[model samples]
Target: MVTLGQLTKKVEFLEKRVKQIMKMLQMVPIVAPWEWES
Candidate 1:
């Protein structure tokens, strides 16, 4: 069973990963994915 502390740690890890991905994308400056899909 997942404890509250474990879940919180997972969420924080995901947030950091997302920030890193965003920074990488900004450096490349591609069109937004949603805009392309629409």
Candidate 2:
């Protein structure tokens, strides 16, 4: 029995995690630009 507020918080937490993952992904390309240079 999840309440609406709890569900919203869970969604927000997932969104933050996704954004963190995106930032990590964004960093990998910058750190290893040689992969995409070709």
Q: lDDT per model, in order? A: 0.94, 0.90
> What lDDT score is found at residue 24 in candidate 2?
92
Q: How close is candidate 2 to the true structure, as a TM-score?
A: 0.73
Model 2, residue 4: C-alpha shift (Å) = 0.3
Which segments of candidate 2 are over 4 A away from where they belong? 30-38
Candidate 1 C-alpha lDDT tens digits along 1-38: 99999999999999999999999988996987788978
Error of 2 at 8 (Å): 0.1
Residue-wise C-alpha lDDT for candidate 2, range 1-38, written one tens digit per residue: 99999999999999999999999988884655577666
> Candidate 2 lDDT (Cα, whole model)?
0.90
Consecutive 10-residue window with the lowest summed lDDT within model 1: 29-38
lDDT of 1: 0.94
